[model samples]
Target: MEQDLIVVGSGNAALCAAIAASEKGARVLVIEKAPEDMAGGNTKYTAGAMRFAYDGGEDLQDLLLDPKDERLPRTDFGAYTAQKFRDDLLYFNDGRPLSPEQDKLVGRSLETMKWLAGHDVKFEPIYARQSFEKDGRLVFWGGLTLAAEDEGVGLFEAERAALLRAGGRIEYGLAAQSLLVEDGRVRGVTARREDGSTVDLRAQGVILGCGGFESSRELRHDFMGEEWEAARVRGTPHNTGDGLLMALELGAARHGLYSGAHATPMDRHMKEYGNLDIPHGDRKNYRKICYFLGVMVNAEGKRFVDEGKDFRNYTYAQYGKAVLDQPGQFAWQLFDAKTEDLLYAEYRFHDAHYVQADTIEDLCAKLEGVDASAALDTVRAFNAAVDDDTPFDPTIKDGRQARGLTPPRSNWAQRLDTPPFRAYPVTGGITFTYGGLKVDDAGAVLRPDDSPIPGLFACGEIVGGVFFNGYPGGSGLTSGAVFGRQAGYGAAASLSPAT
Candidate 1:
């Protein structure tokens, strides 16, 4: 089959690229490794939280929240300017400045979000996950304001509908094995079907949005260390680095931190692999990340990362590795009734790995593999260190910190004296790898010589360098949309039409 553009991977980025290409009057074909029911790549398992720059509450109102909502009067979603977004991108990389391509991603974020909204993807304020009622006003922190109307699956369905409407075609269960390069230009893709049948798909342009190696045990162990093999996959099991491997075979320059990944603390008892059978609405229940609102102690009953060091969204991705490095490759998040209501929605799952008790000692005793005596002492010492003078607040950096603690609680530090203690067992759940084919600002895949590989483009998790060790919540979706759209337009422009 011949197409004007061949997009590998049926996820958000690929869909966006396909739609953009078709809108330019190009015939686009999307190839997916998963079956029809398992399409959308890692995006299907995400929260669909999208972080972008906006002026303030009034500006965010048009994008997600409604400024005139009767419930919020004093809430301030202060301006998140492009400068702030740029700073955050560099800050997480240890003050190392972003490449020109990364700067382009940040600069075009808001405009690309507007483009998505225009294409029928309804945006809604992420009140449930990103905001809290503080002083009678709903305050949205962390610069993440919006999510798709129904979340990840919702975004996926919407994008799929939009792509089909734009005259784009998709073939499921067909995996792209390699690129067809002629005269140093990608001419098409050679793919194999589920039945082991090979087919040649000729195209003027190719865009790779297939995810990373998080789901491949061998790749995980090779790139992220041996412990990664035991880590639970938080998304699709089909992301085996096919896109990355195909690109590498063609002399594409590999970039970013290959050994790093986006991981988080998930229920220790959840299935090792992501279960598609889990009700779509409840798929995210396996996650146990609200630990920043509490404390995390390892098997030896010792506090590890500073639980209150930052917002859970900002710190959750990296903390999973910390949990994996623990004695039993697991940890427990402890919280009290005082902040119990503040727990993220995922903690309420019926099958969550947790235990509840009226006393701290009883709670610690119930935590299997945990040292009871040390657990009790740790809690007592943590409580004693809480600066009682500082008022408790969850909406912002209230500076209610614990004084003189080894790993000090930097914010929202409250003593666990409120009775009815609870703990949730957690282990590392890997999301996606951070390294893949390097690309330019236009999403054109780059060769080892740093020159563009003609007619080749990339986006999403398979296109790396935006993130490293830390990630701000909601940036993944934003980056996909921004760069995906760019890749589509770039691909279309690279075509010679009827020539």
Candidate 2:
């Protein structure tokens, strides 16, 4: 099929880009392997935090502080990069580019947010006021963390519909197997449809928004190293990086494989928390404290990280355990009646949201196979730390603040002392990947020679440089809107001569 443009993913980024282009009077088509209604990409399962910048938008606090939900703090910066903002601990690679690189990337990030806000996407300013005591264990939480209404899916569908209204077509369950490149320019893409038939899409330009390679174990092993096999797949399950593979086949130069953004997200989410049901996987559940004040321990029941820190920082800390086989592989959140109460009273308003254990022995039985003995011992030690409100004697680097959590006077304060010592298992989920195909500011995929792949473009997760070193809320949608518009409009702009 001949078209003005073709996008190979149905994610928020892809959808946003398609709609942005379609709105501008461009003919576009979106192809996806996932079901039509299923928004299973990173957009489907994200914290959905929309981080507005200091550029010029909302009036918010300079620093993040959540009085009601003290567990997760909100910064005034909203993931903005500034001299006043402290450095992100988890940035392992050269994720944050300076000057020229920063110009294109940060400009794109800010532009994306501006575009989304202009498009009527709600942009809320988190932490516009208030201050609190830094028990030193406070973790940062965004407004976007826990809205599971599938609004993201709705957004994608809305965009897709609008795109179609503006003269675009979306073909779900169609997988692009390869790009048919002629000479140096990308001619088009050959894809597999749902019915096992083949369809060749010929376009004046092609945008690959299919997302990262997180689902492919082989790709993870090849690029991210062997340790990634056990790394949590916390993002959308459908993001298998098919587009990346295709790009490689077309002589796309690879960069930044040695580095990426990894985070340890809580596992057993849908099961343990009773959030959703999965017919394919086993029933897994744990006391859901991922959003609450929590503690993390390893295979030997040792406290690993300051669980209250930024979730991205938590993942970086887990990277330290990479050499330990399951280095960042498994972790557990240890909490009790008091921690649960604080979480509920201020953080989580739901009384029924906590895990209950009447005794240490009972809690042990519940956590039996996972880490019973170690958990029980850790509970006693934790209670001891809480009793005196003193620093834990253990020497965990950068993990002191979490270990220093001594709950301000409560009935259950010293309660490794009683029945039901509760423990909730925490494993990282892959909400997004910090790696992808290299692309220029124009949204064109970069070749081995650092030149644009003609008639080829990328936006969203398909482009790595735009996200900065770490992602802020709304950046994903913002990037797609900003760059998708660029790709679409730019492609449209380029077509004037032909007209």
Candidate 3:
């Protein structure tokens, strides 16, 4: 297959790259490892919220502190926080620093959100602080509503439709095996088809958006260490970080220092039975959120984050240490009668397939099951703190010092001495890796010295320049969209004249 632009993987970044390039009047082609009819990559299974910027109308302009593109509603948190992303990357290179250039990329992302939402990409702009909750004890019902697979997948299909309408080519059910670099430039790619045949694809430029290493156990073990096998893959199995490997071999660098990321049970199960656990017709109000919030524990039967905070931040980087310290790389979510009721209605409890016991003795029958002792102890300690004014200080570690938070988790523990205790057992490490090929604000891949890889562009998880250390809420896909467009537009601009 030959094209002006060849995009690897059908995930958010890959598809968005393809769309951006195609929209810029380039003949683009997107290849996937999955079957033609199957959901090929991770974006299909995402929460789909653009967390970069929100309009919030006229009164919310204060949030737009360091306005970059004038298109996205800028906020102090995003402006300063995103500008300071490089400080988080000290773990890799002490000398390398990212600053103002990143702000440019941030600006582009803001504009991308505005353009996409205006294009009818159904999204909810949320401007809440990021928080964490370990093992999801709070009974979260569904995921943040955004562009569903229908929209995400539809975006890809529409791009293909537009490309074909504009004379572009799309080859699915074919996996990219290697890059054909001649004269230090990406000219084409080697593809492996399902029928076990290899084809050499010629292209003017290539966009690597094949996604992170969620399905690649070898890559997982190499970067994330022990958390690899225990990591529950929330992405489409086809996105095993193949592009990252290809890019690395081609001298590309990684970003987003942390190799791991988050995938909720709601996200994991929904990939297959994922839809079943969501708020359906009659199953909506089976539990309350506060119940799930109260008893959630790490591998050690203790709360690690403020379950009361918004779900986006609470689940990302929080509680990962316990999984790294434990055997199964897993954690548990527990609750009781009244708690379950709160989860049902408030948290929108998904499925009934949880570890349930009518008595404390029965609940501790298994080690992986609910620990009656820990739950009992936690409830007792919390109740004592609440009634006796135990001067409880709520603080959590963010790979940094612990900051004091008012009203420690379970600040009002009412005691769990009653019957009908239940638990939801879920185990999955942070599967999203922030490292990949480095890119500039225009989403163009860069070298170690920060020079753009001419005729080469990248976005999403496949590129690392945007991700500093930890991720801000809505940043992953948001960054992907922002850079994806830039890469597409920027890559197209490189393909000028008689090429």
Query: Which candidate ranks first by lDDT, i.e. highest?
Result: 1
How well is each residue in 1-499 modelled by candidate 3, as lDDT tens digits?
3478888877667766777787778888888777776543655444444444323233223222233534243322223233333333232233555544345555565567555544434442222212122243211111221232233444444434534554555677889999887887888789998999999988888888877776776777787675555555544666577887787777776665545454433211222222223422322122122322345554455555554343324344434433444444545555656554334332333444456688755664443644557755655555344333333222222121112323254343334556787665544434366656777756677777878766667777776645444444445776667777778888888896874
Ranking by lDDT: 1, 3, 2
Cα-based lDDT at residue 179, candidate 2: 86
Candidate 1 weakest ten by summed lDDT: 59-68
The C-alpha lDDT values of all candidates are 0.85, 0.52, 0.54
Whole-model alpha-carbon lDDT for candidate 1: 0.85
Report the poorest 10 consecutive residues by lDDT, candidate 3. 137-146
| Regions of model 1 farther than 4 Å from truth | 61-75
TM-score each candidate: 0.96, 0.74, 0.73
